[model samples]
Target: MDMRRTGAIEAVSDGGTVESIATKMGNSIDQNKTLQKTYMLVNLASVHAADESRKIGRKNIASQQNEIKS
Candidate 1:
């Protein structure tokens, strides 16, 4: 993955063809993009789950406090 685009860029900079660069790097670049998106989604889901757990804990504490007051 790292080798694909960087190598392509280097090749072009060194006077290689632009015509096949995309063909050479396309699949790896796409895989990298998909991986990035998947990581982002997993991170978001983890954060959301953590926040929901915190909310539920706070609600339980509030109910317990009200019970003691009564």
Candidate 2:
């Protein structure tokens, strides 16, 4: 979405008249579905990163506990 907004603005400005501007804007909005998918993928990646971090943290805590026991 952020990437699209920047590109859309440039496209609209380059077109410069009412009809051309509207056409560019409409095209930009239509392209938003791709951006939506990209956003979803990024969120999924973040969830994976967090899950991995939690597993690592738990393992480290267990290792510390074992060291203390010895």
Candidate 3:
């Protein structure tokens, strides 16, 4: 859950940052495209991190069960 929260924070922070950068770009087509790409990547990373955290949490439970079998 902590990882998910962190990722959510990071994703929101990056979105705000991109908005700031876009406002500054004004009329720069090249920069706007770059910023859009960055936004996509950052959000994608946040989503993946959250998913991995869930998988890790499940794996931990599996590990604990395996320990009891020994």
Candidate 4:
């Protein structure tokens, strides 16, 4: 929150209008929310990918035992 307020102060110091600064802050918040959602989705995808890889690499002990009986 302080970081955002400080950014607004900097924006105003750089001659931005109050309305534009407020809009920029709102846009930043929305962008952060979107980025957070994307971050979570990426983490979820990675976890699922890892699970699938593990499944693919797993050996079937029953199949191996049956083959040995042949």
Candidate 5:
């Protein structure tokens, strides 16, 4: 269902109390912020993993060059 319609349904379910609606809205916002922070952490982890992989690859390449010289 559309969000607006679902929200209206929720409001109705809560007996249309302003405080109840505002509290629900606040909870939703908090959940969204939590989700956003989680997404950022995952993105940062991916970047760090990629950087570590590059470092490993560079080390391998340098080792191979030393082996060739020897």
Candidate 6:
């Protein structure tokens, strides 16, 4: 084969490799963003649950105090 043909083949191969690497990197970045969002949602849910628990405890304490007064 001629040198020009060999060079063309090499160029095409390199382009494919670069494109594949870029695609993989993009996918990895997307995955990281998704994971971060999921973690944030989980944290928010935990905080909400804690708030609800505190509210219930306060209500129970108020009930007990009223009972003692009665």
lDDT of 3 by residue, 14-44 (tens): 6645444445445342356654554434466
Model 5, stretches more than 4 Å misplaced?
1-42
Mind giving the per-residue lDDT tens digits that candidate 2 earns over 17-48?
A: 33453364565433456643432233445767
Q: Name every residue pair that clashes in candidate 2.
A: none
Question: How would you encode candidate 6's per-residue C-alpha lDDT over 1-70 as one tens digit per residue?
Answer: 2443333334434553433432533434224555324322334457679989999999999999999999
Error of 4 at 67 (Å): 87
Q: What lDDT score belongs to each candidate, Candidate 1 first?
A: 0.58, 0.56, 0.58, 0.56, 0.55, 0.50
TM-score of 5: 0.40
Tell me the deviation in Å of residue 57 in model 6.
0.6
Write the number of the candidate with greater lDDT, choosing between 5 and 6: 5
Task: Give per-residue lDDT, candidate 2, residue 23.
Answer: 62
Model 4 lDDT per residue over 1-70, tens place: 6676556556545666555754766654334655334322334457679988777666566568779999
What TM-score quantifies how close candidate 3 is to the native fold? 0.33
lDDT of 1 by residue, 1-70 (tens): 5655456546555665544454565544334656334322334457679989999999999999999999
Q: How far is candidate 2 from the true structure (C-alpha RMSD, Å)?
A: 10.7
Per-residue error for 66 in candidate 6, Å, reads 0.3
Question: What RMSD, rounded to one decimal, does every model reach?
Answer: 12.6, 10.7, 7.7, 14.3, 14.2, 20.7
Worst 10 residues of 2 by lDDT: 35-44
lDDT of 5 by residue, 1-70 (tens): 2564356445545456444544655544334555334322334457679989999999999999999999
What TM-score, computed on C-alpha atoms, does each candidate reach? Answer: 0.39, 0.40, 0.33, 0.34, 0.40, 0.40
